[model samples]
Target: MSVESVVAAPVAKKVPVEREHHGDVFIDEYEWLREKQDPEVLAHLAAENAYTEAQTAHLQGLREKIFDEIKSRTQETDLSVPLRIGDYWYYSRSFEGKQYGASCRCPIDAEAVGIDAWTPPQLEVGAEIPGEEVLLDVNALAEGHEFISIGTVAPSRDGQLLAYSFDVLGDERYTLRFKDLRTGELLADEIVGTTGGATWSHDGTHVFYQTVNEAWRPDTVWRHRLGTERAEDVKVFHEPDERYWVGISTTRSEKYLIIGLHSKITSEQWLLDSATPEGEFQVILPRREGVEYSVEHAVIGGEDRFLILHNDVVDGVKAENFVLCEAPVADPSRMTQLIGHSDDVRLEDIDAFRDYLVLSYRREALPRVAVWPLTESGYGERRELDFDLELFSAGAGSSPEWEQPTLRIGLTSFLTPMRIYDYVPATGALLLRKEAPVLGGYDPDEYVQQRDWAIAGDGTRIPISLVWKKDAVAEGPKPLLLYGYGSYESPIDPYFSVARLSLLERGMVYAVAHVRGGGEMGRLWYEQGKLLSKKNTFTDFIDCARHLIDTGVTAADRMVADGGSAGGLLMGAVANMAPELFRGILTSVPFVDPLTSILDEDLPLTVIEWDEWGNPVADKEVYEYIKSYSPYENVAAKDYPAILAITGLNDTRVLYVEPAKWVAKLRDTKTGDSQLLLKTEMSAGHGGVSGRYEKWKEIAFEFAWLLDTVGLSGE
Candidate 1:
């Protein structure tokens, strides 16, 4: 009997090497892609894009192919809403033969309000709860804004009050509002036009939140009384630190509020416990420098404490975090490494509940989940449960129904939409709740997930992820979009996307170059591509493209390279290196002037970012390296391929001024007949466009430009 299962059984097998990449055919395919084209097709492609009539006719064809491809390749999985919560899967799409029309508790469902086919769900996949209406329309709840969508939702400790937020159309401004889940009465509403987070005090007397200013930097802490409608929002805390951000969490007893100050990549937590919004604030732990700390909600032996997920600079920033013993702010001298990095894996998806730490992470290509009991002083031995598989996921709190045992997780992959489970933290055992399988006609077996490592000039192995329709590679160069982000320690992980369907179904090749500066391969991977070593990001991206061409994945001219922000900077630098090698180049909110960006500390995130990108101001070493590959400075008076650079009118980070300056320079200095076009979102900020349809339209328009410029139409 399954009385209590301790730790997950080892059922996940290692992913096998691909048959195609390992066989003799691999060499032939690589040579075939490297083989020079006949030049006849290339000439025709060029001519068609140049002639006005050909350009018009070709765009229509491109549109048809993109839609057809999206439908054909990703026909099995529901791309609408895909997330897992405790013992229950939360999605906007239909489930268990029941359909949602235009309102649901899901975030995406709320965003799709008013639009056709938009429906709301009660967050239930199947079956009915007694007295609980089998349905809840999220659309009806959106009262003030036409483009309102749920940003974040939080429940009081007693679960009596619920707080949520939404933003209007074309405006980055948000409205923080709360509603009584039981009474369904409007509680309180405040206009917050920034990236502020709303959470409640333990007793539910005070509502705490942090806000951002026009500069896009988080600046204030606002508090409101729970029962009052006319509660004045008095600012309780403010840190004028440039490029600094704060995250808040409260102790289980609600006696203390934890505030973490993050400057650049380093951070430390401070505590504040004020009865009124204007009460005195306290510092729990003194400030510590050069340490990276993160706070998450955790349950310890049926008691809740603010868990600190952190790592210290032992020998440089190549560090791994662990469960440090203490509150949100801990004794820096006593911070201990609870978990260590693996030789072939990285740890993530950490949460606390039921006296145990529930975690899900990747080992090689497989995913696994387990729990470690939260001991009085530290952490207990890790216990693995019955689920460790290739396509399974587990997490804490993806649902509101989970209560007993309280250990929950998410599981799914290429074929499965999502499977959520609630389990006993001490014992890995599934709890009864909901199962959300896709209702549409879609299958996961029609395509493949390929992982190939491309070796750079210095013999660094950069991982490249490829998702393509089976046997879709053509006898000639296939239309490919190569994407990468080489800064900010952001790992470009393997995740599914519905938007990618348009490309995959069209016999197009999609690739993600997990280049330098990403945490994909862990801390070392990030270290190799930052500051003085930043060139690694651009060079690594170039290597990924070269690898694709060299491996018969796709030819040079048949591809378009893309990135945004720092990745946009990546796109510009690489394009400059080989303008004749690409057919189109796409960038959004690009930081092309890397040297200038570092030099100007006044820019958003620039001053604080010197620790990551280096202050080229005083150090001659930093200055030379930055100028060596700064995209804007390197833009020679050479003709480039068709380029599409996107920006926002009010962007603060990366600044509209950045892309503004870069575009004007490109228009003046570019020698290529390659159309240099810039599109600015008049009302939006750093995020270019809003709304689902708007995003699709923006992407479609930009892609249309690529197809027209790269001569990939009318085939």
Candidate 2:
């Protein structure tokens, strides 16, 4: 199937809109594509979708084959490990033919105590369990909607009511609703345009949730009573700053409600006693630029305290990576350091429990979990949990009950399926609760996972994770698919994927470039790759690709690059900077017109992103710097690789117009006759689609394209 032999591509009409920022004037020809309500814009998007379908029609069989492979290897009829919350053991079940999971729970044994009481009930996948009650069947809720996303399924403290939210339009504005769990009937209270999560008050009379402002920043927290109208909900807190977002969550102990106000580089938390739903919230700490912190309620030495993970100064020295401190609940200003800051370790989160505190951090570019004992005297020794795999990810999972004796830890790697463990803090026992089933005679020994390093232009070493079938790569320089997401300090950790097996069995090598602008190597790595130094992310990725080729892992012609969202921005930058390094590029929801998007304060999430990408409107230097590297602005008349850009029509973040304009400009400017396609999900959002099966098909479509681009279609 020659892509070049397909019908002529859809040419988007050029309607120039001049944008001037910091005395710099630029003409955007495809700016008209941003209007979602315009019939012409919708028609163009439909035409582009038709063009993409016609071009990739030959790959439909292969897409189905890959999808079947994924389904065949996955345990379709499955149930997650039950988590104990209040009087019920809550879990979700997935059926073979179902698109969504069914939330279920069983009553806990009141007669049982200690280990027997805390241990989750082991329920079979298809077996009928005694006292099993279905909470929410998402499949039924998604009956009429083209797209449906379940946001929050929070149960009340007494387990009598459930507060859940759902989004049907894919714009991320959810409609919050209440359900009487005892009667299995929905209540009168309903709130619209929420940010998708609700925190229950201790007495179960009210729930606190957040709502987004015009800029799509969750800036207001509201408290809604169970039996009231939506308009009657009280505004608990509102963040006036556009750069900050607000979120509400109750402590694990259910003793306090925390309202966290955060920007990219700073944070301030407000705390209120959960016992009093109408009580005023007190500021735990004032927001300071460049200082970020998170608080967890803990009872130590028979006194209530706030466990704070912060990057604030200690003894006049800045704790950039962060340090753990404890302060009196009444006066949070008096802080006492519990764990000093470490330059090598990045403290990500801290969860407090009755017996211990779980510390989630990153060390040596890998996630690490540690348990600190809480005794009657004070804090005891801290023990770090160790895993055997060289390239794997391990973190604290859903252990919601504060008094539960065990910590749920989720572990996985490129070769290992997800394994959930209950870590006994008292005896230091790691009890394996469940391991995800992989059907069709799967074996981890058949695959190999390796960690390699590439030196950047500045002499900094970047880590690259490589995984492939041991036998498939014996011939050397096999077709490779390189994945990257280096933005927002988000790391692409090693994990097992059933869909990726389709690529590996087809003799393709998969590698992840843990470049800068990610949290893989700590805060310093992210700091180096963002704002003014953002180009380092693109160069680092290119260097990683070169290292792979130089080491005979894969040749340039056999390689295809993939990234989404901010990483899609990375893709656009790299395609313009080093188009010769890859045979093809696959970007989903690409932020190609970044400079223009950043310059517009009215766009969703643009104002809050100033800390990550500099404010081009205010800073002329930043304006020029971003324009110099922005992919849409840098599209040149040069031979480029086959490019496939995917986006969703209703996406609020990294709107669909960026990629539309990008592909349209690429078609006009690029010199090569290479395949350039844009596939837009007309009914979906930033996530592309809803439902597991639909998501799997989406992955299959992407995998098929990547395989075909790398000459592995016949495999």
User: Candidate 1 — what's its lDDT?
Assistant: 0.59
Error of 1 at 184 (Å): 4.2
Q: Where does candidate 2 have its weakest 10-residue lDDT segment?
A: 1-10
lDDT of 1 by residue, 1-715 (tens): 1213212211111222221211211111111111114363223222222332232333765665554444343323232333332212233432221211222232233233221112223333344422332123444443453344445566565655666666554344456777775687776465466453676776677777777755556667777776655347667778787657766666433555777678756776666663443466665445567656665555554444555555554445445532343452334344435565454555655655435666666554344667777777657888766553343334454423222345545655443455555555544556544444333444568777677889998999888877777765567667888888878767665556665655665577778888988777665577789988888898888888888888777887788898999898888888788776677888888988776566656555676778778877777677777777777667779878777777765556765545544554565567856656555565566776654445655666666666555455543
Segments in model 2 whose C-alpha atoms lie over 4 Å from true places: 1-6
- Local distance difference test, each candidate: 0.59, 0.91
lDDT of candidate 2 at residue 625, scale 0 to 100: 91
Q: Find the candidate with the highest lDDT and give its number.
A: 2
Structural RMSD, model 1: 14.6
How many clashes does each candidate structure show, in the order listed? 31, 0
Model 2, span 316-380: residue lDDT tens? 99988999999998888789888898889999999999989999999989999999999999988
Best prediction by TM-score: 2
User: What's each prediction's TM-score?
Assistant: 0.75, 0.98
Model 2, CA-based lDDT = 0.91
